[model samples]
Target: MHQAPDILSLARKAPVMFNELELLQYREQQIPGSVQYTIHRYRRQSQFEVDDMGMLVYHRVEKNSKENYLELRFCISGNTYCRQKEIECDNCRFSLSNSCEQKSPSVDVLSFLFSPTHLSQFINGGKMKSMPDEIVHFRHASSFSKTLTLCGKTRTVLEALLNHNYSGSMENIFLNAQMQMLLLYSLECMIGEKEEMAFTCKFLANESDREKIEKAREILLQHIGEPITIKELSRKVAINECYLKKGFKELYGTTVFDFYQSQRMEHARYLLYEKGLSVTEVSMMLGYSSISHFSTAFKKHTGIKPCELLLR
Candidate 1:
């Protein structure tokens, strides 16, 4: 692998500018096992040069370094290590307590390795709190299923681009589409752990106040299509009507009825956009007895008629 300089030479050709000296300084501290590889225009797909096991290995940071990257890693053949604050995803640790094996050797972990600039685009100015001095780890986790997940079709499109297998506007289209797919995939994985934790904590909070809020959420989730009243909703979640109204907003940041409406609208959006369901069909599915009522609510919430949005 050291004999191959095609892509490596391309990377070297783009001399690391003076302004990127900080990144260079950080890169110098990488672990002994780490190596940097680049993919530019090469000729053969098979010869695009992966690790011995066919993984595209780019060791971007030192093992002990505190730098956190908006990173995507796949454990393809062996156990790997990763960490970020109090959160831990350890396969061996998780498996010692339980007896299940991970489904695949190659498992994808993303979102944590993203650069500060990339994250700031979505999070405003808040990305730097978790800064260059924080040791982010992504150790193997037992729960990582061997699903055929791709970070973006970009992994595939990137492979194509690196191999010089295609050309013209089609190449540009593939790259753009793949990049978007990869970005979405990275975002999804990045939030997966945090979202799961928040959900679990909210649903399982020992405090009565939080439980009541969760129950209120459950009621909304269960009866999204029903013309449910605050009074009836309070009864279902086992809370007083007044507390249901006020306590729910305090915990969830939204009124109980507002949450319920949001749930219904979200379901309607998924049906219309993802499942290709008809507006009337979705309206009926959600328990709305009348198409006009569903349409009115949908339009009121989304600012566009369901029929018009459906065409989009």
Candidate 2:
């Protein structure tokens, strides 16, 4: 495996100028099968208030039998507010100098670089024609890039990668598994777009209605702990309940109830395994009325009870 560039080097190459850039975390490993991957978490803040910023990463792999590879990048952005409102200074939030209570906008980026040989193993038993372009073209093109939608599933995996408690070998195992999942979700999002375009609901043809449906989905995510009714969701987004349901299913590839339940269960599993929270605590945090009810619902979604998962 070749050495990849560090986060600071990549940040310096970005198009937008940032007042401050910090590399919060970085992890890299080479597995037994010659698979090498790296994770970079960065916090960036700009002084001049820009609408958008973009980064460009350029790398040249060492000459070898394997010349092609794939790169996956995920970015989550949010604002960080300071606790104290009175004290304020220029560049206080962006700089590490003064200890002031303030919140500023920050962007976190996670990137995964996969080797060609590692990816090729998946197609080793089959013909190249049967494989997807993302796989087949890895060996054909020098470099290519595609913008994929950051769906809910993809966001969940990215969040897990950002916040985890594993270390050493356990960390390596967890990262490798999550990287594969990111790849799977990316491919699925790409393929699902094609299918969606072929059979999109006519109701979504209107841009305003589509926005309303998207807003409804966001509301559903916000209230995962305490789910809202379909009528309430429609009212919040100011769209008809029937249109919201049909448009949501058409756009997101799942019903509202199923999506909400799946998100809740996934969060439950995260709280149990990662946070080490007790089943009862997680059950209550998720607004479950009783342990047995939570257990039954968890088992229905995950094929195992919460207690069983905790025991693992």
Candidate 3:
């Protein structure tokens, strides 16, 4: 007798790769602004060729290429994993593929490519006074690579496109505005990162407080299934409630509740898409009594509807 395999277990163990099939659906859009970004969207399956000679291939065929531009990748939804080579600006070919050991249904990635000249123009045009020294140092350095976390407002800007999902001149205009906003927010985050590093280097005295806040963060994650008040969390960590609230934001750049809720939705996304959980099931698991409320929260966190993800 054959038994049905556990799809959820398979999902957690499989790798999500961007095979040639994914890239075949690539559509390029004229990016807005003087910086001249080129956006490539992969919407459907790959278009890889199968050799009629009957060659047995078990893995995705590797493709090599060189890049002369800066690539900004936002894993908006689905599998949040990719395999990318180290940034080599000298036109050297290297592996460019992504795979995650998780059963992923679909993925939506927004890529913005920029030439070095255009990058300089963007910085100068946007008033580079606020950019951090890391950028400045990289401007003169031989090689550099950076990974930045997108803040809530930046993510919201990306999500708002859901309300105006269309394909036309209006779409271009709206996307242009959103791109400009994302770029500005990116610079702002860099500045904030620099300020944080400076403060950390200067204030060795606040180290203990920083550790306590981190401990509180772990407790919040462990008890995500159940809601906990600020007072309760602070008591567990032996920190004052007020200090806990303030330090939570000061350390992580978001309120405690916001952070906790955001984490929950990100987890919810994985469960709904990768684990193949139904909307009602996900809502109940997340402690939402109403599916409408769960849908709203999911959209808020991911910029699209729960049903939309399921459809994809």
lDDT values, one for every candidate: 0.44, 0.62, 0.53
Q: What lDDT tens digits, residue by residue, belong to model 2 across residues 200-264?
A: 57877665677677667667767878858998988898988888888889876689898788778
| Lowest summed lDDT window (length 10), candidate 1 | 22-31
Which structure among the candidates has the greatest TM-score? 2
lDDT rank order: 2, 3, 1
Candidate 3 lDDT at 39 equals 28
Please state every model's RMSD to the true fold in angstroms: 22.5, 21.4, 18.9
Tell me the tens digit of each residue's lDDT in model 3 across 52-154.
1100001111131122344444544432222221232222222222322322223344555444444555444443353343242223211222345668987
lDDT of 1 by residue, 1-312 (tens): 001112221223321112212111111111122222222111122322222111121122234323323333331212222221124336444644233243222212121124433334454433334312221222211111111234444365434433343346664555444444554554454445334544323433435555565556655666755667887777776767776676677555677776678668866877877689998899888888888999998888777788886676
TM-score of each: 0.36, 0.43, 0.40
Q: What is the alpha-carbon lDDT of model 1 when measured against the actual structure?
A: 0.44
| lDDT-superior candidate, 1 or 2 | 2
Candidate 2, poorest ten consecutive residues by summed lDDT: 50-59
Residue 303 displacement in candidate 2 (angstroms) = 58
C-alpha RMSD (angstroms) for model 1: 22.5
